[model samples]
Target: MDLPVTVGIDGSESSLAAADWAAREALLRDRPLRVLHALPLMPHLLPARAAGGRPGGDLLHEVEHVLAMRHPDLRMRTEEAHDAAGAALLAAGEDADLLVLGARGSDGFPELRVGSTALLLAARTGCPTVVLPVEPPGPHPRDLVVVGVDARRPAEAALDFAFAAAHRYGLPLRAVHAGSVPRADLGGEAALLAGALEPWKAARPEVEVVADAESGGPGRVLVEASAKARLLVVGRRPAGPAALLGPVVHAVLHHAACPVAVVPGA
Candidate 1:
């Protein structure tokens, strides 16, 4: 069976936005869209509510109706889980093509860039995760996908994702490397950036490629590049026992103006 593009929602405006974005993504990939809502688990002694009265059932129904109306021909489904948010989403996304989420939930603080559940799952989920910004992006659409390239890390997974997305949308792929080298050494930086992207460029010759090397903090540089990009792609090494996300990935997930795709890598 083909894997669906799944999105986790919690009745927040941000989550609703993510659902909308996930619908478009599903349409682009020619896959089904799964809307999931994670509800707090109740004690075993309590009686189970009817399907209609289940917590979050109304929200799920509303989301389904809205997305179905907007995407008339899209195949869609909704799921509600009685479990902690992070665990529920992680499990739901295991068999999915991609997992999309809101930066924060309804209960999150307004000042937070991302919620704990989103942060946890983004670092730990086996599949790639797309986390939308706090507010849905505006109507200014650009035809570019930006991926951050790190010389020290193996970024094959991220490069592959970026290239494929660009090809799918007929957009240009910008491979950005944020090195701390002095401005005078930009020539060397550009050469290294080109070399890093060469394999993927050759793999997808139909997609246009732009190599950019900037002198600054990686996070800041990538976030700046996201301003004109439709999507920003970054690699996250599988989480260790501590489940730590690298600083650069964490920064972009929170601050990038465009939707951020966190692809799992070595």
Candidate 2:
């Protein structure tokens, strides 16, 4: 059986948007879609009236109905868990081809765009995680799929994913490397970036690869590039139990104009 695309639903507009995006992605990949809801287990039982009129299960049914209406022929399933949202989604992602979540949860503060659960999963999940913002960026005709690379520690996983997405969407692939040096050093940085992408360019001859190196903070450069990108891909360093996301990944996740994909790398 093919691996399914999994998405976490919290009845928030952002999560609904994520579900919609996941549905489209599932269709593109020819895979099944799985919607998962995570609810906290209350220690004490309250009267029916004291509780909300509808149980948490109703959210799942509503989502299922919405998906059916939008994608009648798509194969989909729903699952509910009485566990922490992060833990449940992490477990579900173990057998999934891709995992998606909303940038913010229902209880999230307006100023804090990304919720804790999404951040934790992106940092720890084995599979790729795509975080969709509540208000998606414009769909520009010239939009490309962008990926950020650290030439010193290049990651093949992120480059491969970006190239595949570009090929699938018939778009160009833009590989960006940000340097802290002055503008004069950008040329050498661009060359290093090109060298890092040379192998992938050969492997995916159809994908038009553009290498760019700019002088500025890495996060700022990538976020600016995302203005005209359909999707942004970045790598997460795997440090075992001591793993922590770099500043660039954190900034991109919180501020990128389009959906962000975090791929684990060595």
Candidate 3:
């Protein structure tokens, strides 16, 4: 069977927002939506009740009902996992097309930063993981999808995902490369960035691509662009335990205004 778009739920407002976003994505991809609730294993104590009522089962049902009401045609299912949030989500999303989670949970601070479980899952998940943030509704241009492109260790998976997403949303794709040298010194790097995107551009000629080479840190550049982007796509380096996520991806996850897609890259 085809892998579904899986979302981790914890009854938080941000988590529920993630569920809603996942439903829309599932409809767009013509895939099933799997809502997974991970209950931490208790050796001696019973499970703590979620915001609604009971622990796992009731919360799942409530989310199911909400999703059904919003997306009547979506194919949805719920599952309860007896494990840590990060472990359960990683295991359930092993074969998933995409794994989605809220940037923050109920225990999250008002600063609206990413939680530990979300960070770990994004770094370790086999499939692409999207982190959704809770923001007030406002008017903003949504015609572009921003992607952080690294010429040194470019990730084909991330580029492909960005191109496909831009094509799907009928938006332009902006490939931004950040460097420390002056803009003049970045001419060669800019050319290299364009060359890297040549195949993806040809593949989706319908999507306009703007190649930008700027002087500064990559994290700041991508985060700034994300303010007007429909989605920000970044590549996570496959590294050892200490270096799972590069500085660029880590910074963007914490500061990006829009939804962030972290794609594992070579």
Candidate 4:
């Protein structure tokens, strides 16, 4: 069976917007869409009692209806789990092609850019996880893909995701490295960036690839670049249980202007 594109919802506007984005992505990938809601069941309630009556339960049906009407040919399914949102999504993502979620959930403040669940899922999910901004898309968006590249680690997973997405969307891909590299090492950084992208460029000869290395903090540079990008791809090294999300990936998840995809390092 084909792995579905799974999206986690919590009945918040942010999650619903993610659902809409996921539907379009599913269409692009020709995969089924799975709408999942994890119900935080009450201690006294049975699993079935809180199955489809939670805040997000009704919204699941509504989301299915809207998506079905929008794309009648899209295959879809809805599921509810009596567990924590993060755990449920992590399990779902193991068998999923991609996981999409809102930056924030229903509980955060208006100014919050990302929620706890989104952060955890992005760092640990087996498949590449896309975390959307809490607010909707802007009026004018750039049709380009920006991916963060680290020369030392050379995240092959992130490069694969970025190139594949750019190919599917028929957009340009920009590989960027943001750090305080010594002036003398600029040439080496450039070469590393090119080396990191060489395989992807060959694999995706049709994708337009641009390599850039800037002098600054990774977070600051990537966030600024995201202002005009349709998507930003980053990588997490998954170092043990405590340090899964590195500083750069964490910063981008909370501040990226466009949708952010966090791919686990190989």
Measured by lDDT, the strongest candidate is: 1
For model 3, the superposed segments whose C-alpha errors exceed 4 Å read 43-54, 136-138
User: lDDT score, residue 11, model 1?
Assistant: 83
Position 79, candidate 1: lDDT: 94
Model 1: runs farther than 4 Å from truth?
A: 43-52, 138-141, 152-154
lDDT per residue for candidate 3 within 82-162, as digits (tens), equals: 888888998987889999999887666777588888888888888899998667323687679999998766789999999
Task: Give TM-scores for every candidate, taking all chains together and pairing residue i with residue i.
Answer: 0.93, 0.92, 0.93, 0.92
Prediction 2 TM-score vs. true: 0.92
Among these predictions, the greatest TM-score belongs to 1
Which window of 10 residues has the lowest lDDT sum in candidate 2? 43-52
Which runs of model 4 end up more than 4 angstroms from their true locations?
Answer: 43-56, 182-185
Residue 96's lDDT in candidate 2: 92
lDDT of 1 by residue, 218-258 (tens): 99999989988999999988778888899999999888999
Quote the lDDT for 84 in model 3: 81
CA RMSD for every model?
2.8, 2.5, 2.1, 2.8
Q: Model 1: which residue pairs collide?
A: none
